[model samples]
Target: MKEYKFLRILDKFEKIYTKIGVDYDKMRLILSMKLTLDSRRTSTIMQDQNKNNNEEDKNIFNRALIIYAIMGIFIGITAMVSFNNMYKFSILFGMFMFLVLTIFISDFSNVLLDIRDKNIIGTKGIDNKTINAAKITHICYYIFLTSLALSWLAIIGSFRQSPLVGIIFILELIVIDVFMIVLTALLYLLVLRVFDGEKVKDIINFAQIALVIIMTISYQFLGRMFDIVDLNIIYKSKIWNLFFPPMWFAAPIYAIEGGHINQIIIALIVLAIIVPIIAIILYIKNTSKFENSLSKLNIAKDNEKEKKRGLFYKIGRNLCFNNEEKAVYDLSTSIIKKEREFKLMTYPSLGFVVIFPLLFILIFSVDSFSEIKNISLHMSLNIYWFIFMVPTILMALQYSKDYKAAWIYQSTFVNDKRNIYKGAYKAVISNLLLPLYLLESIMFIVIFGMKVIPILIIGFIFMLIFIVIQHIISKNKLPFTLKMGEIDKGQNIISTLLGMVILGVAVGVNYFILINTYLLIIYGVILTIITFIMWKKCILDFSTN
Candidate 1:
């Protein structure tokens, strides 16, 4: 009876849902319960950064909407920009689709992967079909709101074309939104097939990391999609390009806006309409299997997976300074990798270090590897993301849900506490970030030629120096020293913002001399010396206090 506003509106669609073979009452009941629980939850992406860690309960959902609306401003600007309407819309739709997809990947994982309904509702004899309907509905409810926040300006901007066009745009968008969610569902289904419970979770986390880099970096290549001839950006419809969904969605706008609808355009529009219907039908048929797959989440760990020693442990054993530090390194790696809460709340720039250059290559230079010589220097921008992200994510090492075990940090008899901090830092570096950074440097050298070697070298040195400095300046607690609930949200936000300013200075200094081989060598030399000095004496002074 305590229906949310949207659920109340959905009640009017009971007949339509019943026609689709959904149990209207049961689905609504499930949704009402789930939403009631989740409405208290903070948005993972926003995380209400200014909230005091110890603050009592409050709804930051409105704050989340504000964040979405700000993000929407960029999408709105993309819509209003003058270009070939088709190309413009393609960019708009591409950004929109990726935005929705990335947000879905980031925030909707819990709903999509939840197994509670299977245990609770299924035992009551409700079928998987109804349970799945509720799950899908739960995801849709929030996605719909987020999309509207993003789409509001785009939608209103369309009315300038005509009310009928505006109305038509709404209809098309509704169809396209349905398409996106199913497309996402199908992607998850594919992931579900290959990985069992924990592995699937890791893939989802990697996806969150990967898609985010892809979204920001892909914009660099958007201009390439349109051919500029005679000082005019003209988009020619290519039959081969129809494989992209944004093109399918944008074709309707192209046809309606002063263009003769040809076979290709008509086909594109038809697919835009028909494909989502087929996808929905297909998804409905798979509803049971997808629900049943939830059992895997509750299943025991994979025996072989448990047997493997991680590459990080091997590397950390040699890379760390001493035995105690090496032990701490391995311990940190285990906690960081295995803790879901850490993965969810944490922002490891190490992921960015590994993901950024690869995503940059995939986006900017995928088509013209040899020709995009200009992008080589521009690739230095990749370092900016990791630098700016380091302070926030690196801080995650200090907090864990199992904070009670942090007493072990004190129990260890050691002359200096710095070893404890140093060990964990070395683990993060050796286990993954360091090797991947070097590997990516080799890939960059191969693709962009030797011209980018100095940039890559400077980036690696800077990554080491920055992480050391940030860790030293951050709280001097032992790893996993505080409960996750006690995260210093406000302090963390301020420090992260401050890190951005410092990182900007680092980037500016790096870029100032990057083109000159002499200054580049000098800068790298000075940076390397500073790195050694910091790693030895200064980094530990404040880090262990």
Candidate 2:
């Protein structure tokens, strides 16, 4: 086994795990070896063939860490709301665990399981118990590191109060982390044991999408919860403690601090100790079954290729386009739908567009519907919606993980490249823009009532104009034909910001100047003419590199 930094630290606890039917040293060695190999594999891809790529990877990681830190700060600041250390610790730890759990679900397969590891290490005489244990250890180390970073200030403050409180805080976090890891592992193993490997793999993919949705939703809701429910509410209604796992740890701390500890807290504390043990037992018993299915995960099902032609294809073919345009539209939609990397990159942004606008409305509103019904409010939100939508979808259309495969576009003997753009435009409109527009329109109607129809119509027209302008500026690449790493991030950000500003001004004008229906019609017609000219320019004169 390689001399892993983690394993070297674990060496001090040799006698502990050895007592529980675990070959502590041997398991550490195997785990260290497997994780080392996996790290090398990831590092190789991240660093790639040059120094610049390595720097870019570092920057991306740093940016990711910064985002995580920002999330932590939000929770930390929320935790500071009450002077009660118990409430502060509970809220911060709970939110941190939630974020960590989200990350675990999103990246667990790649980070811990590494389906490839099953094949690589299967030949080595390692038992399922050892591999599974190593996986738990590997996941724990990283999540703990992240938790430490997230809770540094809170933990330090706890230590200021008393060394025991701080030590308990750290120990409680370890227990919670262990419970979460075991719970997730048990869930994965159970799914594998019950369902086929391919099904489990599909579930994992879908779960990633769900994780993003959940992340945004949880952030918004959890922040709201902290704002609404303070220590008084929590103390009065102990039922809240029963639902939140972090409260289990917090209750014990409260008890230690000479605070009131009730039956609910006592039960939670007991469950906190028992649940992880049960999870570990369940995982160990199912490891062989899990491993068997995992090894066969990559084997393609014969039925996958036989998927029937769906409504998307029918819609694509019948879209009001000439043959060339229809072909581009179909191809573009196909890539967006079928390409995993494209879905990963694009769907999250689409989900964000779906989520963020509503969240912003809720955040700003006194009575949600009453505030939303205000013309200026809805117009501003619509401006933000269209602004974010155009850039995100356009940028998503430009990138593909397998960009080299795009050579087919260059090889084809086509004189008019604009037809390809037209087709791609239709794809963007029908597949991406239309659904989003309908969703926004429906939401507007619901929130503001039937009287909002004219505003929605006006908003849709402006969105169309924005989309056309974006296409003229952005649709130079063949759809899904550029590598993600090669994308101009600054260009996209600038375009998005500029779109927001222009549309924001338009929103203000339409609200203040074109308040009545008659003035709105006049403005809409003028905008329509401008949009038509831009559309013509986009399809006829614009060329992509």
Q: What digit string (tens of lDDT, one per residue) describes model 2 on residues 100-123?
A: 776665445455546655566556
Model 2, C-alpha of 459: deviation from truth (Å): 4.6
- lDDT for 25 in candidate 1 is 93
Q: Model 1, stretches more than 4 Å misplaced?
A: 49-58, 81-83, 207-221, 229-231, 300-312, 344-370, 373-386, 399-415, 476-478, 481-490, 512-525, 540-545
Per-residue lDDT tens digits of candidate 1, residues 239-312? 75566677777888888887657787888888888889999998888888888876766654644345227665
What residue pairs are clashing in model 2? 476-544
After superposition of all CA atoms, the RMSD between model 2 and the true structure is 5.0
